[model samples]
Target: MPKEIKNHICEEETFTGIYSKYSKSLHDFLYYKFGEYLDPNDKMQEAFIKLWENCKKVPPSSARAFLFKVAGNMMLNDIKHRKVVLRYIQTKPKEYTNESPEFIMEEAQFFDKYQKALSKLPEEQRITFLLSKADKKPHKEIAEMLGVTRRVVDSRVYNASLKLKAELEEFNKFYAKKPSKLL
Candidate 1:
């Protein structure tokens, strides 16, 4: 075999060996952290691709870290991109409270207003809110997904809740003043 072809074959074997040793744990860790919004299967593939691409520089001892670092950054970038797209694209709004609406018109209006308010939030804060409130992910998991510290995730969740609460309260006040047409 030619020198380059032989070198490539050896590199492929090393990459496969590294993946066999670490892919499962790496995928599990990523799933726990980013499965809510990120695609675990795709991210796993990307990690392997990055590992192979950087195999020459990444020592075997540090391969795990390299895979995680690459995958984590890819997930974060995906989140940021999705956040930007979601800002312009409309989606079904979440009901903050369990209280039933008196009628269809009132229900529709409530959802519309709630969605508008949610759309106004920054993308990062909105993602933090979704992970905590919508997906019920733990702080550490969210922190890992976003490549941030757990404390940062905690603060983001806290602030998001406060903001949502205030917005809902205001919505309630406005809704209360409207005539009871639905009833």
Candidate 2:
């Protein structure tokens, strides 16, 4: 426990002190968990606001955990909303484009294969790969975020790469047999 935790968070100076103490760590946690799609700052601010609103209910010693719990719940809600939106988007018809049908079809096929391969990966591996490759986060940071050892992150990424490589190779071979102008 830090000295800030001893202060009553309802007081203006104490509240500001608490915010200064935990805001950056909380924001980083949310960002690492949610990735680039969602804004962590908004969620972090909302968590602090909730804390201020419920100041009377939370005790000094437990404020940190309380804040994290509130933020985590908010993030879960956001994830659920995003899933619904994604499903809705997937159901909607695609717009017509000026590109050639062959090019469009090939692109769609490639995307489908890539998605399928990615989906087939184990959840942990997929997450590790995405955090490493898509978010461009380093192994140590990912290790800290995931609460795992750096070696574990490295292993997960290596295994994921191997699986994706094997899957993509098969996809390429299948496409190679087809008579397409794009290839």
Candidate 3:
């Protein structure tokens, strides 16, 4: 019988009660949904703060849904922002004064090929591989986030690795026959 619940608006007591009841579940849900890309605890806290801000509009019964909706929206916004930043980084020119022109060109070509190979992979395999490799997430954690079993995550990573390896090997062979100047 928290005062906030009794009042149907967020009071400090009601907010505390609601937070104690739902914060962990909400955090777990966000983590599972977004993986390592987001900070679940921060998002969870933001959602609760939003709830407190709009307590008059949100009833105790609807608070759970409201919090989740807020958190999900926040996560989506963050993802969108991250995409923009990554795109900017990718397109930005690098200035390396010490490296030879040939070396820089070769490095850029290799990265371009690598990106193409990654893009060509099946979506699920690519995502799992990136999560495991780029984000350094463990198999069990990835499985939980993806709502799949650990074995499935394992299989996806293995398959992705094999495919990427093959693609890179082919690229290397194709470039090997060419003169270094051409590469």
Candidate 4:
């Protein structure tokens, strides 16, 4: 018998003997390295299972290293799995818009007019305006996401604002000139 095992136990009582002795230190080690990525309890359980499976061959002196290796490998696998899941989520399609018929028709008319007005503006101005207004993306986040300066985003917003004001004024005049509704 190895000296380490002889000092600890004559014959291994049960896996619980191993767990009660070393679970805390092993849990602390896994938690420190992986943090929120994995449950420390689950990792501890898995580590003990590995130790139990190799109990006959394992000397108590080297048991800690064996448990740590098993848990460390599990953490690495979890990180890789999370990356793949995140990529899949990012690539998923956007949801269809749900709205009443009256709302949808109103939106269609507004969008048709808006699209015509947007077409008259410069490309950069239109993109910034649509992203900021229609998509409601914040200027700073948009700047970072698009790899552009905040000043450029501000400039595009200003040009878009001027063009929209002029176009809306013309639209108001056209609507006002039309005959009043019977209702």
Highest-lDDT candidate = 3
Off by over 4 Å in 4: 1-11, 93-183
Clashing pairs in 2: none
Q: Which whole-number lDDT from 0 to 100 does residue 158 have in model 4?
A: 83
Cα RMSD to native, each candidate? Answer: 19.4, 18.8, 18.1, 13.7
Clashes of 2: 0
Q: Distance (Å) between predicted and true CA of 53, model 3?
A: 0.6
Per-residue alpha-carbon lDDT of model 3 for 114-151, expressed as tens digits? 78888999999999988887787999999999999999
lDDT of every model, 2 decimals: 0.75, 0.83, 0.84, 0.73
lDDT of 4 by residue, 1-183 (tens): 566655452255645676787899889988888895578779788878777777877767777788889888888888899999999988968676666788667655755675688889988788887788667789997788777999999888888878776876544443343312100
In model 1, the clashing pairs are none
Question: Worst lDDT window (10 residues) for model 2?
Answer: 174-183
Candidate 3 Cα lDDT to native: 0.84
Q: Rank the candidates by TM-score, best first.
A: 3, 2, 4, 1
Clashes of each: 0, 0, 0, 0
Clashes of 1: 0
| Worst-scoring 10-residue span by lDDT in model 1 | 174-183
**Alpha carbon lDDT of residue 58, candidate 2?**
85
Write the number of the candidate with greater TM-score, choosing between 1 and 3: 3
Candidate 2 C-alpha error for residue 117, in Å: 62
